[model samples]
Target: MNKKLVSMFLAGAVFLGTLTGCTQPANEGKQGGQEAVKVGMVTDVGGVNDQSFNQSAWEGLQKGEKDYGIRISYQESNQEADYAPNIEILVDQNTDLIWGVGFKMGKAIEEAAENYPDFKFGIIDYAYEKTPENVVGVVFKEEEASYLVGLIAGKMTQTNRVGFIGGMDVPVIQKFQYGFMAGVKKANPDAIVDVQYANAFNDPARGKAIARQMYQRGADIIFHAAGDTGTGMIEAAREEGKFAIGVDRDQNDLAPENVITSAMKRVDNAIYEVSKRLADGNFPGGTTIVYGLKEGGVDIAPTTSKNVPQEILDFVEAQKQEIIDGKFTVPSTEAELNAMK
Candidate 1:
């Protein structure tokens, strides 16, 4: 009836279609100019609240969320079997990066990396062979940190005897023991170090038992790298009024009066740094990232204002700087141990 009016109606319909396309859910503008890149972490068997490696890794994720506006989430594996599934969940979600929090998850991470070559991954404490082009292996100079702790233990022991309790009899644990013994020897050659391993990450009872045995054997101070197992060591120290050193995190607050210090691994920092890189599109892949004293990856906790002598605190601070400056190298390998002899 009216050709011009029909043409105008068609034009209006085209305009409405354009508006609908612009308003589509997938094309709608995001709240923050860009969608937040999600970061996911799969924790080791000790879980995220273990107050150790898992806790540190979670802290890094939190830091990334706060600093870079990232979306961070985590899944704690209660069993070794859950590792692969948890990693798969993250990868399926299109997470920008997936962090595998401990050496125990190395195999799972390797599998996930191979299956999802386009996704980025970061694994702590171990590296893999035939790794995809999108994985970063993060390890630490734990022996160097443990050596410093040994020096402290050696110097502070009134009985000239100390003890070390490790979570497992792995090479990583050996590094801690060797470094500690070397540090003790460097500081007080006459001092004795009693070393033991619990062989489990979650057994606090075994840790306490070992610490009690060491204490009965004239050990005045004990250092534990046993994850949750170390909690029992601190408890033993508190009950007996002996000294205990923590690992991975600042556990001084756990048993304030009994815990002299902790061998800090700065796992939190490593996680945050990697997550930040991923957010910035600078994801580190096909490379191993080793953080140590110089990178603030490891150190001793601050001496609290109680029980710690001012002179000892000063000495620790001085030695810390020396280690950072490379003036003092802490022994880590069999050859280094032999050189100390």
Candidate 2:
């Protein structure tokens, strides 16, 4: 709600609060003797404490509660079967708005919106082919942010080989892979950008194994789009004395000696902004809102300077401006990436 906070995030500086177990609200925070407007979120399989977007989204909701006195709560889905049931829980609680936190929750949200015609629903990372008037969609241009970090990897890598590990093989993950690959190519054409997928967002052991494999194969830097799985990547980085690039949140603290930087996708800001819009009687139902480099939704972490050189930072900053100024497009798909070369 404060301009200063948003400015801090856009300027590549952020402080993420850690939240543990979360529960649905018990009708607290009354405004004028009436029950406060309640907002509920349903996270994907990564749960709320994945230290990724799910955690970031909850932090934003917590801020909304502090700034606007809105009652905020979240339901963590441990598996796909939990989605509809979680939405039902929020619906039963009479939440003013129900947010689904990932692309995987699209069908469940859409179904719930259709089932409960009077309620409002919003989703992240998923756009409906035909959006219900009561539902809103939010997506991001993650490729742009990943490209900046990839540029740094290309410039900083001693082995001329960088690796990318993804939680899933979805189009969203592809965006990160392709954009990172393109940025590496742009910076150093001879460098190789190795890519792999864990196929699960919470598989830390699997993620660790992948990172070790990449590092053993001469990759000195690795970027991960995996959720909790990425914690393992950062851990491996610390053990191997290598560099890891994080996603979703500023994760440098995970291994200050190892993690070089993080690709910050500010899901918290988006959630807070949307909640404020809702409080202001401007619920963005039936529309899709996209956040990108230009929209202050994504950027390289402030911790970048600890490892990346000034010239590389300046170069990436210029590229950021170039993207915002419409001077060039960062590839988000396989075909677009190939076209660049």
TM-score, every prediction: 0.88, 0.92
lDDT of 2 by residue, 1-341 (tens): 54333334422321132222235554486876776778889898898889887998988898888888788888778888778767776776678999999999999999889888889999999988888999999999999999998899888999999999999999998998998998899999989988999999998999999999999999999999999999999999999999999999899989987888888998999989998888878998999999999999999999989977799999999999999999899999999998985
lDDT string, candidate 1, 19-82, tens digits: 1111101111232688877888888778778888788888877887777788877776777877
lDDT of each: 0.81, 0.87
Off by over 4 Å in 2: 1-27, 32-34
* Candidate 2 clash pair list: none
Model 1, position 252: C-alpha lDDT score: 89
Top lDDT model: 2
**How many residue pairs collide in each prediction?**
0, 0
- Scored against the true structure, residue 285 in model 1 reaches a CA lDDT of 90
What is the alpha-carbon RMSD of candidate 2 to the true structure?
A: 8.9
